[model samples]
Target: MAIAWSGSLDFTVERSGKSLMGSAVSGEGLVNVYQGSGKVLLAPVG
Candidate 1:
């Protein structure tokens, strides 16, 4: 099953030698994720 979440996150995904690497942050000034499996991250738009 897929979970849904909403919040503000600063994430960056990039390719590193044929691999993908990135960082994501949540709960920063109304940034939160709900109903997510933790691995899944969702951000809100205004």
Candidate 2:
């Protein structure tokens, strides 16, 4: 069998059986992914 990421691609962990809320992008090339504990990321992808 092939393995998959098969997981939530959010920046946080939430109830409702672990759900993702929303995402945002700023002019400074910052993306904020919200779920439980929100995250801020830069365009300088790692």
Candidate 3:
């Protein structure tokens, strides 16, 4: 697997006791996960 991109990628993933919620996000350049970025969506097929 090859990862090709520029800029900085920062994330502070954590867990709080009992929880099944996972937060997935995505953005580029000045748009960061902390400086107010967009969200990534994941779907569960039924």
Candidate 4:
């Protein structure tokens, strides 16, 4: 989840090489990338 406090915020998901380093890492080989100006709040859930 993401929240833009002010200005603008862009969120994107791309392939993560670091996450694919190990087979038992338990990741989907993807990462969330947040860019742009202003303050952004990010929340991660399990």
Candidate 5:
């Protein structure tokens, strides 16, 4: 699998205890996740 974004962007990813959250931009659209723990969240912008 692959994630691609156009141009350039800066983002911060934070993890507390067992949770993770971040915001990112992809060629297809916006990508984000909040309060995620112990697993992977894959969202396809396309």
Candidate 6:
């Protein structure tokens, strides 16, 4: 999860390096990339 409180920011989702093994094997290897300047919050969900 991600939240941008102010200014500007960019958010993207991409396959993680481990994705090469496939989701079934790697447990959905994916990641979130955030760029730019801002007050932001990032959290992980299980």
Candidate number with greatest lDDT: 6
After superposing candidate 5 on the true structure, give the runs of residues whose Cα lies further than 4 Å from its correct spot: 16-46
Query: All candidates' lDDT scores?
Result: 0.34, 0.33, 0.32, 0.65, 0.36, 0.69
lDDT string, candidate 6, 1-46, tens digits = 6644455867778886655777557676787777788777667878
Q: Please, what are the lDDT tens digits per residue for candidate 1 over residues 1-46?
A: 2234334433333333332222223222222323423355346665
State the TM-score for model 2: 0.17
Candidate 2 wrongly placed segments (more than 4 Å): 1-9, 12-26, 36-46
lDDT for predicted candidate 5 compared with the true structure: 0.36
The per-residue C-alpha lDDT of model 2 at residue 38 equals 33
Tens digits of per-residue lDDT for model 3, 1-46: 1122223434333443233332222221222232234343445555
Alpha-carbon lDDT of model 3: 0.32
* Model 2 worst lDDT window (10 residues): 18-27
Top candidate (TM-score)? 6
Q: What clash pairs does model 2 have?
A: none
Distance from true location, Cα of 42 in model 5, Å: 8.1
lDDT of 4 by residue, 1-46 (tens): 6644445767688776654565236565666777877787667866
For candidate 6, list the clashing residue pairs, or say none.
none
Residue-level error in angstroms, candidate 2, position 24: 15
> Global lDDT for candidate 4?
0.65
List clash counts for every candidate, in order. 2, 0, 0, 0, 0, 0
Sorted by lDDT (best first), the order is 6, 4, 5, 1, 2, 3
How many Å off is the CA of 26 in candidate 4? Answer: 8.9
| TM-score ranking, best first | 6, 4, 3, 5, 1, 2
1-46 per-residue lDDT for model 5 (tens digits): 2253323334334432332332222223343433423434346765
Q: Which ten residues in a row have the lowest lDDT in candidate 1?
A: 19-28
Candidate 1: list runs displaced more than 4 Å. Answer: 1-5, 18-46
